[model samples]
Target: MEDTDFIVNYVKSKLITINLEILIAKDGEDGVRKGQIERPNLIIADLMLPKMDGFEVCQQINSNPKTKDTRIIIMSTRNSKENVLRCYKLGIDDYLIKPFGLDDFEQRITRLLYS
Candidate 1:
């Protein structure tokens, strides 16, 4: 996961108790680097990231043959239809809006990871 401190910390805390390995990046560039290096099965990112922004990150990762099959769930406050369409166009698996409840977040993650 790559996002603000609060979101990253909160999600990390929640997943750690469940024994999940969380790789975090503070900016879009670092996120892309980690995505390439770690090759995680799922990536949860915020749209308004520093440096390159999440859209570009998704584009780059999805374009790469090594990471193209990886599932992506974008979390952001920008829930416009245009943004959602753009995410899907970039091959995102899911687009989750920010301020979502824990149950909703968990459900989305579960669906993407297990379904």
Candidate 2:
């Protein structure tokens, strides 16, 4: 997951115990680098990231043959239809609006990882 400290910590506390290897990125560029290096099964990003931003990150990941199959979940407060469409255009697997509860987050992750 590539986001600020708050979201990273929140997800870590909620999901780390479940054996998910949570990776933290402070911004979009870092996230992309880590995604390329780690090749994690899934990536959760926020739209308003420092540097490149989530859309660009998703585009890069999807475009790369190595990471094309990696599922992307964008989490952000910007839930406007336009933003959602933009993310879809970039080939995001799913999205979640900010302030999501633990159950909802867990369910989404589980569905993506297991389905």
Which predicted model would earn the best TM-score? 2
TM-score of each: 0.92, 0.94
In model 1, what lDDT does residue 69 have? Answer: 87
Cα lDDT, all candidates: 0.84, 0.88
lDDT score of residue 87 within candidate 1: 90
lDDT of 2 at 23: 79
List the candidate 1 regions with Cα displacement exceeding 4 Å. Answer: none
Point out where model 2 deviates above 4 Å: 1-3
Candidate 1 per-residue lDDT over residues 24-64, each given as its tens digit: 88798998888898899988888899898889989999999
Number of backbone collisions per candidate, in order?
0, 0
lDDT of 2: 0.88
Worst 10 residues of 1 by lDDT: 11-20
For candidate 2, write residues 13-104 as lDDT tens digits: 87786789877887888988888999999999989889989999999999998899999999999999999999999999898998899889
Of candidate 2, the 10-residue stretch with the lowest lDDT total is 1-10
